[model samples]
Target: MDWGSIFSNAMASALGPDAIVYALAAIGLNVHFGYTGLLNFGQAGFMAVAAYGLAASVATWGLPFWVGIAIGFGAALLLALLLGVPTLRLRADYLAIATIASAEILRLVFGSVTLSDWFGGSNGRQQFANTFYDMNPYSSRLDFGLFSFSANDAWVFTVGWFLVALSCLAVWSLMRSPWGRVLKSIREDEDAVRSLGKNVFSYKMQALILGGMFGALAGFMLAIKQQSVIPTDYATDITFFAYTALLLGGAGRVLGPVIGAIIFWFLMTFLGGFFSSAASIDLIPDVVMSDIQASLVRFILVGAGLMALMIFRPQGIFGDRREIAIDGR
Candidate 1:
């Protein structure tokens, strides 16, 4: 079954750009869902707007990359305000619905024919990452036995992982502060926090903005990795996968999402490659599952695995049961 190649490829995928992107996204989700008790089901929307912000600013308006970065953060902040002002005081599910709906609406609008000129209407934007790659220090490919990457990917990884480290450090530091404790207290019981004279809504909005900024950074990393932006790239499915990563790693723990992202991609690519190799060697009947089916079966297996985890250990690999016991109310 060519286990060597399968394992090698899986390892590579674990450390690849996709893993970095999702790790950042899941980190943002951890802040929203794990720490703050926010049901932000539209994290992908944050990522989308950020990506388009950079793309449109650079490709359409001929702005510099740094300007694009500013625009991206602005868009994310605006989106957070738009979503939080009317919904933060409502039920948790209301925020979920609003975020998910806003994300879908934004995706459709970006791809709409009327906005094709600005957003490129489905094909997305390209050639916007030159500035990032131009700063690469490596002149040759990096081969690390089980994994290898191009010079460009090396640059992306260097910047992306650095950002991830900074995000984790920020989360770690913030969660230890008095404000961070208040956030957790609010998560456990908002009414109590409110009674104690803390402005619950304000804290929630701050967390939203903070987390959305993290998501925007992920979007920037992703856009730079692909050197382009597409509406479909930020689909709701991305948010779900990120959530899966958060749950797998143990949400609310500073490193949970990061570890979860690594493990999730590792298992996914490993199982996928293993199944494809087995099918190629005629160990599995074609009628039972084709090559395409082999590729997709991993997600089914992963889904079942997640269900098992939720049933047996809902707190996840690193989560404390008491921490997640907080009422969403």
Candidate 2:
């Protein structure tokens, strides 16, 4: 029951590469649901396609890593268009249904035996990340007193955080521009924006593309960090978690996702460690809860916290309540 180890693990997760990845994903969702009032439940689909695009291009087609990156982003752009073209003009819920269903379809397709040759079924692909690692400058691991990371992890962290920063800056800048104003206006009332002679449909499409591209970048981070890509990694739950992080940090605010990701992972790992350590000390009877059950109980607690947040503080930690008052109509 070493509390130090547990605390270190939790702290690492708070600022780790995984948190950066989720932050990036939530940033994309912020653009859709936060700023533009788009209900894109298939963000995981965008991530999955981008990851597979990169893996298949480099591993199967023998393309360069950079080219694979381009292909992956291209796939994400295509997906956004395909999804938005048919559904954006309809009610918001239609887009939600379409996105969620499309994401599930993609997960199944990638894991299906019929496409095992290209996607490798459920095992996914590796060996494509050598090019990324070959460029790493650090020769040894980074030893920070509380936590340490391999050279590879250090390099990924550098790139991942840089991307997160760049994305946030972009969102901030965009939201201040005329285009950003139109997006916000649409979120509040599409009819009003249309009455002003603005192209609501086109604006929605653009938001979808921009947000999906961000999600695609997140896909790259997740894939490059682990040096592998799996279908299960892009499940529907990932999107839900991103939404949670978005809500936690304060949606419609540029930096909400970043803060939310840190807090969410911190709480998750922190509670996990405390529960596991308590179990080891035999403080609780087995009849109360076993070690395995402790692992899941943390999520239950976090879920309850989220419910409380929704009930008492729906605007989140940094979000202004009015910012989220956009009319879905």
For each predicted model, how many residue pairs clash, with residues at least 3 apart or on different chains? 0, 0
Worst 10 residues of 1 by lDDT: 320-329
Tens digit per residue, CA lDDT, model 2, 1-329: 78898989998888888898899999999999999999999989999999899998998789999999999999999999999999999999999999999999999999999998998899988778789999999889977899988899989888888999999999999999999999999988999999999999999999999999999988998888998988999999999999999999999999999999999999989999888778767876678889788777889999999999998888999987664464322
Tell me the spans in candidate 1 whose CA falls farther than 4 Å from its real position: 322-329
lDDT scores for all predictions?
A: 0.92, 0.92
lDDT of 1 at 193: 95
Model 1, clash count? Answer: 0
Worst 10 residues of 2 by lDDT: 320-329
TM per candidate: 0.97, 0.97
What lDDT score is found at residue 265 in candidate 1?
94
